[model samples]
Target: MKSITFLTAMTVAIAATGAEAKTRLLVNCFWPSSHFACSTVLPNWVEEVERVTEGRVTGIIPPKSVAPPPEQLAAIERGIADVAVMFNGFFGDAAVGPKVAMQPFVGSHDAEAMSKALWATNREYFADEIEQVHLLSQFVISPAELYSQTDTPINSLDDLAGRKMWVLPGPLAEITKKLGTGVVSGPAVQSNEIISRGVVDGHLGLDPQAVQAFQLMPYTKSTTKFSGAIYSTSFSVFANKDKWAEISPEDQEAIMSVSGEVLGAAFGRAWNEAAAMAEAAYADAGIEVVDVDPAFETALQEASAFVTEGWLKAAEAAGIDGQGALDFYKSQIGEMTN
Candidate 1:
């Protein structure tokens, strides 16, 4: 009887020990090593998860880790990594359906408003389009501005006409075409090479850190600020479906609690600070900054209608209620901006 009791006790102890082992997740980021989205915001997410789960869940980040930014969603779906951060524009080829968020001039310049709108849109309509993975949170960067290699300046819509411009393809590309500029499509990391080799006369999708990260400052001569931001990209955190299912319910809830607006606010603060840093760097390098005149701003606004119409068409082709989503997004943006 004593031997049997000891065996039972040992089995229980071993089982308890196994249950106490930490759950580990691998997070993949496509941003460069120095980008704040990778170095600052993602680390904060890992810390928050561990803190909330009381160390039952831990994350591992492999350095210089990334798949092609557009391929990140597919990677997560395939379990290439337990978690990944991906951009909406990267999936343009997949017919992943209309991501209205990528359409130029759709949202406010403030990340908070854009992030909230994205989150709400996902909850209301985008779940099926992104159903392959478990979504954690969605966000938008500040609107992209135009950067140029000449001090010639772009004050009106007509200024962009006949210029060779590098832009990410999709609605933005279509808009550029409508404006009569030749558009070159590719990733941000390749911008320096493209510009240096004269593949493009200028670039349209300039973010402060992105320009800095790719070392494009030496090639750029001017920065143009529009009346409103021209374009912005949407991003989200995703986990492999199987991996997400394996997490304990308690830990899952803990993670979800900190994901949406909370994560967006944190990311916005980080991005805003990084933008400031980039501005300082540009100033120190003697790069010229140009703000658009009110007359040109109105012309750019008229040109934006083409991009918005393109989004509506794409959304309809994908069978999504494009008008409904757009209206809701606008409403949310107004509320958040206020």
Candidate 2:
């Protein structure tokens, strides 16, 4: 009887210790819960974490974002959330490494390729810039195109400048303002407010999926596509440093087995599928898809030179070989495309 009682006590104690050792992570989503990144990407990663850790590590996302879009990284840094996604633009001049992915006419429309390349480049050159939080993965959406609600298609800079345009903040806004366009800049989620009220003549920084997701197709009469992406936004997924440290080293390696380039490619594939759906929706919505004129494309590329030059200089200041990274990124995209 004494032996049986001792064994039972040991069993109970071991079970309690196992429970105590399990880690539950709080993941926050800045976009609406229904947004693919929220509904799909983060949740998928959480599942992978649980699977790889054998249920020792798990995660849950709050119904809504813990903070505003621009504040996501700060929230993670402050430990308000264990993990979150952040736009590179929110980093401003503090980190120029991401700008290599944002340069005009340099990125591919393939989200997966660009995302993998971004991760590769980050690991090789920009790893030091991610000091505030534990970097997990990087991703970019499909390239953005200029869309017009007005009768006139935005085939030339004059047409764009003639109308007040709603553009995504960061490089696109700066480029438009430099080219003399009347610009209103904000997060993509807030685009509907101004657009639905006729506050702007057109929008300058949404891809097909974003247009469909934001319900902008009804107001869009035409969209102009460039030979190369006009611009693409970069995002970083990261965890709170303290929270990351709490995980066992074994579990950390297991979690990362599904992160980095693997996670990036997963995000890219999702975007590619979504954009394809949005393209079909564009046809059904009767949104005219206009090819950019070669001469105007050249002129616009020339005008956007300052954005890239500024990025190169800023990257150099950060001790990264900006040109080499940019060239490598482009080459990676090309190799993947071919």
Candidate 3:
């Protein structure tokens, strides 16, 4: 009888231990599985998470698996995904702190500097908005450049007037429209289709790697350097608030230690590498790359004022202090770049 009781107690304890040990986290990436962010950065992040957690946490990334880039945040909020990489521009209707980062002329062309600035901005002013979800990391992509099929170069601001251009909807689209270009809203992944079909005369947001990743270089006849980083997208790795709450405090600290500034720098380095690869690919493809004339760069800078004004108006409508946030973000970017 004593032996039987001891055996039963051991069995119950083993079952309880097994239950407690089981942990699964779902990580969603909007980019296709082949993209560097999904293929390289995510895997490295997963390894780091598991290593720090010591087998208490495990993550699974489904192939080509993601919600619409804009919907990633809602998916997490609804518990469809425990964690996801979200783009701030997608939250057009909300008070996302990073909107200031997307305003024209606010960020430098350097992804590393932009990423650091974004992280610092979050720490100083946007913490509450992001705290709703457990932010794992923050990063920014390189600025989008102009790619065109026309042999005539974009040497001046007037060159863009009345031209049909494929532009992603949101802040970037707003900037394109302000430039007097006919804007077509479409996913970045479909840029090849748009260019191949001649639905667009050119595209305004082709990052070097993105152009190469989607094979847009073949269709691209010319590339124009923008005055400054025309615009950049902000990305954040976040988990559901409840799910993050379940993590042990020690585990949370471990994760946070690896996130923010450190993770931002890692992503920036990856983007820099991707940019190098893209430049080589474009050269090999015989595509013409031109630096915008100084006069044109100045025109672009002047045009940027309209974009900034529009952002301020939009932010006011959303009940956020647009000017204050913009000022803070600018100061942070200056510090990081300097």
Candidate 4:
């Protein structure tokens, strides 16, 4: 009986040691628990990591954000968080490499394509700009769809004239201004008050899936589906350099197999699927979705030139062929669609 007990104790000890050998990474999900990043993307990515590593390495998202969105990258860089996701625009110029993803008229409404294109382009050209953290996946918000409080038809370019509209900072703001519309600029969170208080006649930066998260469907009565070049926000999921270094080379290869562009493409596909749901929600909410004519599309395309030109110039200053990157991204997207 003593020898049998000794053998069982040794078996348990070996199992405990093997379990301790697994590397568990803490994934910092600053988005709300219900937010897609917390509820879906991170969770799904974590599963992939565990599966690919065969329990060699895994990750966990804390109950609350370790830091605010803008600070997520810095937090990871400082080692406060092992992994994090950041909105590239919030840090402005720091994530200049992926800014190509934000240039209007360059991509289709296909989120998966855009996400994959950005990752491919980054690997090809802008990896230097992303030196601090290990870029896991880079992506963009689906193009913005204009939502208004009334079923006012925005059929012609002239219809938007003088209307107070909420625009996110950057080229979209320029496009809104060029349309002869008044711009009310603020973050997405401010849309609720801005619309309720009549500060802006409508918000121009949210699509249907986004509206569901913001609870804007109840207040919105109309939506305008712009052409491929509308607008979008860029973001990236990354890991701390040191934390990444701590991961064994074999595990690193395993982790990245499911990360980077693969993970980015997954995020885009998920969001695009959610976009379909948002469209249904729009119908249920009685929101009118206006499809403007070809003329309006031409005008939109024309206005977007300024934004694209400026991005190109900025890209050139950053020391690479900006036009080359843009062209590559578009070509990559085309390939993905095919």
Candidate 5:
């Protein structure tokens, strides 16, 4: 009886220590818990990390984000959060490489292809540009399209220019201003405030999924379709460097097996499916889809030239062959679609 009691106590102590030894990563989500990224993508990623690491490594989303969207990268670097995702545009001049995926009309509507191409391109030309955190995956969202809340159809540049519009930050906002459009610009999360208060007559930079997620359906009266992505947002998933280093190298390899291109493709597929569902919902909401007028398309494309030029210049400043990288990314997309 004494021997059996000692053995049971030893077994229980060992199990408790094992549980305490497991590493739990804190994954932050800036979007609401119900948002697809939080409800689907991030949770799926955490599950994969646990599975691949054979339960040695695990992750959890805190009840709230450790920081706001713009400050996510810095927060992760400071070890306030172990893992997070950030928008490339929010990084601005500090990280120019990811913007290769953001240039207007360069990407297709297919999010998976663009996401994979971005991962490949970054590996080839821009890997060194990232610092402080360990990059896990890079992905791009579906393109933003023109949507009007007012009676205007946005059939011409004149129609677009005449209305006050909410544009996504970065290139789209710059492009809209150059075209003489009255632009109210901020992060996508803040879009509801401006649009709901009757601040803008139209919105120029939301994908179908975003339109659904941001609850902009009632305000959206019509959508203007472009031949390709009018513009796309780029995203990066990363982990705190010190926290990453704490994991065993073998476990790191296991975790990475499910990250990089694999994770990017997965995120893209989710966005694609969600975007499709949202578009289907548009008809039910009485939102009209307007075909782009050829002249308007041509003129908007022409006016947006400076935005791309500025990015290319910034890329060169970062010591990359901007045009070459762009061409490679575009060619990769073409190959995938073909």
Candidate 6:
């Protein structure tokens, strides 16, 4: 028994050494190193990939991102980074899978379930729409709600009017614009500076995790939530095409075997847990949480009409089953959450 144990440990050490010798794929992460994406999601993913492959592959994140948040995809595609995370919405109408995932009221606050649904939807109906890169995993992060730092709270649809709001680009921006708010488009990472400088009166899509991650509690004092998710943020992990091609097919399968929906579900669960923490933080900060009436929901659906139509139009242009994809995604979420 002692001899057998020694041999097994030796074999494991040899495998680890072999994997450690392979060219470590550089993972360019745009989020702060303290942020969960850098600290948890990406790191955990790297470990999982290496472990599942029995140390046949490995990866690492640089000290900082090689490019800005919006330019991550371009950097990876250009081979400036081997693997990277990207906000799908950064590509606008060109990124249909993300647009589909961000559609209003399509998901609930269960980030894990929503993420799994998004992966399933992408695999079945929207993969071709975003196959421009070698996709490793696809995901979304919230059932986002409204947050404010000013005197006027966003309790009603009309309250949204004329407020200069910092919003993420993509369908959420269009949807907010239709509600009569002026939008300042930027990524969530910049929200602290924008809100502090008074660049925008409030932000439109502040999720609980975001509020906590960015220290938004000091700036924001009120919250408005919809019964269902107002909107969600889309993300993807992808490899540079050439870099992906360099991996042996066997290793590719080993890498992919533990990615996609399984990894996406992890992000969902992590975000959801972080959101719970934010809620506790909100309570300590005296942030007033408000739930809108049914009337507000009616007005929201009417106000945001073009967002879905725009997605479908873009989908048709890309030959994707736009409505079908939407239905499939929602159904998957429903199944998982239920």
Which of the two, 5 or 6, has more TM-score? 5
Candidate 2, 1-338: lDDT as tens digits: 99999999999999999999899999999888888988998899999999999999999999989999889988998889999888888887767897789999889889999999899888888987978789888887788989999877899888877889999887889989988999999878889998988999899888889999889998999998888899998888899998999899999999999999988898888999999999888878979989999888998999999999988989999899999999989988999988
User: How close to the true structure is residue 224 of candidate 1, measured as C-alpha lDDT?
Assistant: 81
Q: How close is every model to the real structure, measured as TM-score?
A: 0.88, 0.96, 0.89, 0.91, 0.93, 0.88
Number of the predicted model whose TM-score against the real structure is largest = 2
Instruction: Tell me which of candidates 2 and 6 scores higher on TM-score.
Output: 2
Clash statistics: count for each candidate? 0, 0, 0, 1, 0, 0
Off by over 4 Å in 2: none
lDDT per residue (tens digit) for residues 207-311 in model 5: 999998888998889999888788998999999998998888999999989999999998898999999999999999889998888898888888888888998
lDDT by residue (tens digit), candidate 1, 235-271: 8787898988878898899998888777876776677
For lDDT, candidate 1 versus 6, the one ahead is 6
Q: How far is candidate 1 from the true structure (C-alpha RMSD, Å)?
A: 2.7
In model 1, where is the ten-residue run with the lowest total lDDT? 89-98
Task: Give the residue spans of candidate 6 off by over 4 A.
Answer: 1-23, 197-201
Report the C-alpha displacement of residue 275, candidate 6, in angstroms. 1.1
Error of 4 at 142 (Å): 1.7
Give per-residue CA lDDT, model 6, range 1-338, as digits (tens): 99999999999999887765575689888987888888998899899888876766788888888999889889988889998888777776667765677888888999899888888988888776655678888888976778877866787777777688888766678888877788988767777888878788778777888877787788887888788888888788888888787777888898888899888998888899999988988778888888877788878877777788877888889888888999898888888877
Candidate 6 clash figure, as a count: 0
Ranking by lDDT: 5, 2, 6, 4, 3, 1
Cα deviation of 184, candidate 4, in Å:
1.3
**lDDT (CA) per prediction:** 0.77, 0.89, 0.79, 0.81, 0.90, 0.82
Task: Write down the RMSD of candidate 5 (Cα, Å).
Answer: 2.4
